[model samples]
Target chain A: MSTLIGVDWGTSSLRAARLDAAGEVLEERSLPRGILTVPAGGFPAVFDEACGDWMREPGALALLCGMAGSRQGWVEAPYAGCPAGFADVAAQLTWIEPGRIALVPGLTCHEHGVPDVMRGEETQVFGALELLGLQSALLVLPGTHSKWVRVIDGGIDRFATFMTGECYGLLRQHSILARMMPAGDGELDAAAFVQGVHHARRSGTLLHAAFSARTLALFERLAPAAVPSYLSGLVIGEELRVQDLRGTLSVAVIGAQALTCRYELALATLGVTVTRVGSQATWRGLRAIASTLQGTS
Target chain B: MSTLIGVDWGTSSLRAARLDAAGEVLEERSLPRGILTVPAGGFPAVFDEACGDWMREPGALALLCGMAGSRQGWVEAPYAGCPAGFADVAAQLTWIEPGRIALVPGLTCHEHGVPDVMRGEETQVFGALELLGLQSALLVLPGTHSKWVRVIDGGIDRFATFMTGECYGLLRQHSILARMMPAGDGELDAAAFVQGVHHARRSGTLLHAAFSARTLALFERLAPAAVPSYLSGLVIGEELRVQDLRGTLSVAVIGAQALTCRYELALATLGVTVTRVGSQATWRGLRAIASTLQGTS
Candidate 1:
């Protein structure tokens, strides 16, 4: 029988994991029922459609994370302030249903003058800390909005969000640069990407460096197929350059293989070590959150 | 009677000025017949519709500049190589109809590793120099693609193009940042904009700095209406930061008053002097080009 279910609900998609008393995944399912696609007051039904089949027994505690907790989400789960540990975050959990469905609160960093916020990445960040067993370290979670987190003594001290992936997406798909490239996604062109990184290392600004992706094509230095990868490298490299990476020996990259590898390549070029954490990190964190709820109940 | 017509036909709009034998504008007209909006093979008709009235007399020479001469434009006018002065550039003019209609060639920076092209700004740069009577100085034309032009000994020696304005438009209209701001073009908030420029002076990358526009809004430190101006500052600031501005006594900003003023504010903040040139720069450049053609013929 399923003792718990963990949900990672984001803007574009929803994923679920069914777990036993030990918090190991017994079965899993995913659907494209992201909050953006769901109509008003339709999330409960949509959630059931995505995971109803996996719920064999009656009362499996459901722990939800990500945008499902935002104001525009199903029910506003509110945000937990930063410098919070797993327990501090877990305690502030608000539920969609009084007992059946619990939504994990997102976090906000008040350390900086302007506060930065994240939804799903906080779980992955906490999980990364637990798996790596590090007291103070830098972590990077790359996506539409890439996050750079600082962890100290089992709590998230502070973090900054870089719209690297999102900016790259918008530029490639919508900007004038899109016209220069061929349709569909491109494979990683490591050399072209590294060339982009080298260009970013120069004193030129990003607004100026960004045009190099197109100029490189015009000059025949980079091919059309490699333009996306090169552009990706350009943005990612610039993102890394501005960070005070000095004295930071290594960075923990928590994300999938394809995306993280790009960051790994960029970091490697900068002479920093990297540790890759797979998507399972999110699930592991969810399972741990579920376990805590189980203990209290 | 009209002795000449200078047309600035770009991707989104077409503008023409009828000039007398003395290089004075006798009449002017503009239409939304930019190359991108016109149907394929419909340019001749569209051109006629825009300024056919000015072409009443058959001998009224038409000198077309900008995208109307691109490969996708009316006819492909190949680029003039850099270090090219008036004589070198004017020699490469390819005509639609000899002695009646001519398209000025654009410029390519073959000196730089990555070649950059500008279809319409060349005339503006030349005009700024002609109007100001400068033999050598730095020029910046802010637009979709902001160009930093260097004039030496009365010729465009070399220059760079930054996608500062275009990137800002794309991000504000199509990216996630759009959701954070109010609808329609926003009024400038000088304080918010200066705040963005100040952030650019920091070590954080543009990718990270860009998010501050949203974060500052989230924390209620900035008004939603001011976010656009703030973002504009962030981009223009980053664009200025990368360029080596030390010992450059003054920068000639050639564009509309509103746009040039923002650049002026940014440059002034960086402690550089700015010289503002108006829209007549393009028209003036076109007139000079006509005068040169008249002398040669």
Candidate 2:
């Protein structure tokens, strides 16, 4: 049986999967070392330590995605523009070691006269399309930099990135918003989340709305426990409102359950149907890219 | 010289000025140490280090405002509710030393179903009203947490705090928006700033509008030097938008020139007349509070 290595190398961690020719996961491993961890000329060494054992068999191809293909990444695959699909990405693959290992390029677009870019979400987006046979839809990949992608006719048309998760992290941990919130994990408050979503949808700029998180606590209107969840909804809601997805019939929210669920709740409040999908899109996407490269070879 | 100390003690720094009965500045002093530097029972020592030299006189009385009176400040001066004036705040001063050292109280308002509080801005707002001798005016005090106050007759009606400056600081320093911008203080690009204000006024949520700061750079529509100014305009614009200040005839923008000009430009874009007032509002406000206390004594 033919086997392949599918690796998702990001800013903070490395996640790798060993998949068969049929794209079935045989084994999976994760390491803390991402491209950022690599010192001077340390890519091969880090890759070996993380996934070289799985790559012991020659002819077994490896396909990588994420920041690994960024400018500061292992090898710059550049970026394929919007309306790009698997073939477009695979065509631009930078071969660290041809056939043995290749990295997929990300997607870039000038939407609304603004240059927007996404690295790994392109892979997951294409993956979601192939897995669900989606002809056209809006896909949201929630993360540190959450992306709202537009896919049409089996290709990415354009996408916008909202620094929702990253902003949330900074607000909850570093900004004045942190003053009212309790430390560590807490239960999700759906009511507060919904309220936050409603606030985002209804009126005012995020500049003023953000203060509600703190004021709500000061007034004893919102408990400290719910501040984080409220903030999550506040930011996520702002993202959803800004995307103005009210007209979009459906949106595919693909990511970890925790993050996607927040998007799902916020989107649902906007009257748009939401389809929750797991991180499988990454694997499916990497596999598709790898297969296309092999076919051309 | 009948001298008195007017202190604006905040979270990070202590600013003090000795004013005679005429409310004219005699001697001014500023120290890096604020409420944050005060250790357990160390307020007196820190106070001495900062302004104790002037306080050695027998008849010298100190009127302090700002974070020094917060729950975490020098002394907990309970907040006076809205429609609060000099009497309302001065009544709540938690005197460290009777008639000698008095800290002014902040103002709290449950305006829009959320609890909001202001410490130093309360003093500044009242000070601005008395200094400008204006009635029924919307007072805008720009700072880390900008306050939009309402003054009627001779009292503070109510106010809303927008974290415009604080939020701007976070986005410029910590968020993904920082990735594209050049480091350190760049000259304010008024043209770029006006563009940002227009964008904020034109469309989408602040969440989406903020991303434009980065995307504008990516498209080469904006240069790196202008990002900070654009960001400043963006948040200030949002603050103006959410304040629903369109109908207000004129706004009293009281703060440092740098922050107030951004607000002035933004408010002017909205067609609302803006009246720029200096940081003298803080000193004037404290002087008013001190005179009231003396009259009561």
Candidate 3:
């Protein structure tokens, strides 16, 4: 029986799962895989340390996703465009150090005159689709750069990225709002956020409305720390307004529990129904790509 | 001849003038005065140092304006309502250490359900009025918090404060826009700012539109340093749109030349005529207040 190794090499961490032919996990390990950690020549050493134990499982085909397939990764794989099926990504796979490793190609798409690119999450999107047998659906991946991706016929047709997470980080760390907010306070101010979203949808100029947070502080001495969360609600609310997700069917969210919950809350505030996919969705995506490649090869 | 000392204590700096009974300056000095520098008791020493030489002129009545009259200042002076004629502010003056020192009350206005307040620059507004011999006009005080104040019938009536300068500082120092923007490279991009303003006015969601800066960077790879300037343009542009300043009799900008120029550019983009008031405007304003008080007394 053949064995398989699935790796998700993201900006911050590398997670690997060793599985049997039937996709039953035999072992798993996580290691630091951020851009800073694996400078230029350090990738090989870190990758070896992360997966050295499973090396004895001879002929184990390693499938990698995320930034590991970028120009800066272990192998550079070109992006395949949407309506791109599993076969498209499998065709672009590049081997690193001969037969031991293969890197999954990311997906790219242009929609509504905007270009959307993804590195690792595309695999997860693909996996979610495969797992649910979804042919067409709207996928929302919430994180530092939250993406709203449209999938048609099992291919990523288009997506838009919002700097929601990065904006939160900056406001929490650098803005006056940081002083009033406490760490890990992720609770939703449903009323405030919903109000903000409604206002944003109506007006669409978040730059001006954002000052209201400070104005509330100056005028009423509202806590500055709560401003970030308030801002998150406002932006997310505005996104909901602009996207008009109220009538969309089958919205799938792929991210961590906490982040997904926030997205779910924001969408719920706008009366949108959504399904959540966990971290393992990414691994499953990589697995699906591996299986597709194995079938064709 | 009797003598008077007029002081302007703002967020960053303090300026004190030793003037004769006629309000002619015999000498003047300035020093830093923000809460950051004079935390509590430190105010007394800093104030004394800034005016020690002028204090040698005996029996001069010291009058102060700006944040020095705020709750945290040497003494808190309550706000007088608009049309805050000279008499209103003069009546609310607070004495500190008896007749030797007095703090000028700032102007406060409740108009159209919005409460507005002003500290140091109300003096300048009054000064510009006296200098121009105009009864009603718009006064733009440009700074970290740029104030667009309305003067009607020889009284300061209403105003709105835009955190323009503070926003510029925050974006330049903290946001991704900082990567593209350079310090003191504030060449106004009238087109971009106007576009931003229009976007803001239409959308009314400043936070949502702010990401446009990052989006522009990602899609166009536009100079990162130019982002701050673009943001500035957008904010000012929005202000012009919302305020709808057309065919006003006159526009007087009160602040440093550099800041005034930015406002001028924004106004020019909106096709509004503007004239800049000098640093002496604040002094003249203080003198006007003193004269009005003397006349009433």
> Which consecutive 10 residues in model 1 chain B have the weakest lDDT in total?
B288-297
lDDT of 2 at B248: 84
lDDT of 1 at A65: 92
Per-residue lDDT of candidate 3, residues B147-170 (tens digit): 778888977877766655655566
Highest DockQ against the true fold, candidate:
1
lDDT of 2 by residue, A55-113 (tens): 88867888889988876788787778877866788788888986688888888887556
Which of candidates 2 and 3 is the stronger one according to DockQ? 2
- Fnat of each prediction, in sequence: 0.85, 0.76, 0.17
| A1-297 per-residue lDDT for model 3 (tens digits) | 467788888878899998765555678888866644787877778888888778667777788888887766766777777767766776788788566788888776653333556788788888788777798889988876677778778777776666567655665576555655666656666565555555445433344445556555556634545555677775676556556465585589998887777677777755677798887777677666667655343
Clashes per candidate, residues 3 or more apart or on different chains? 0, 0, 29
All candidates: DockQ: 0.67, 0.58, 0.22
Worst 10 residues of 1 chain A by lDDT: A288-297
Error of model 3, residue B194, in angstroms: 8.6
Candidate 1: tens digits of C-alpha lDDT, residues B204-278: 467878888877887778888899888988888878877778789799999888899899888889789899998
Q: Which pairs of residues have clashing backbones in candidate 1?
A: none
TM-score to native of every candidate shown: 0.89, 0.87, 0.78
* Alpha carbon lDDT at A236, candidate 1: 88
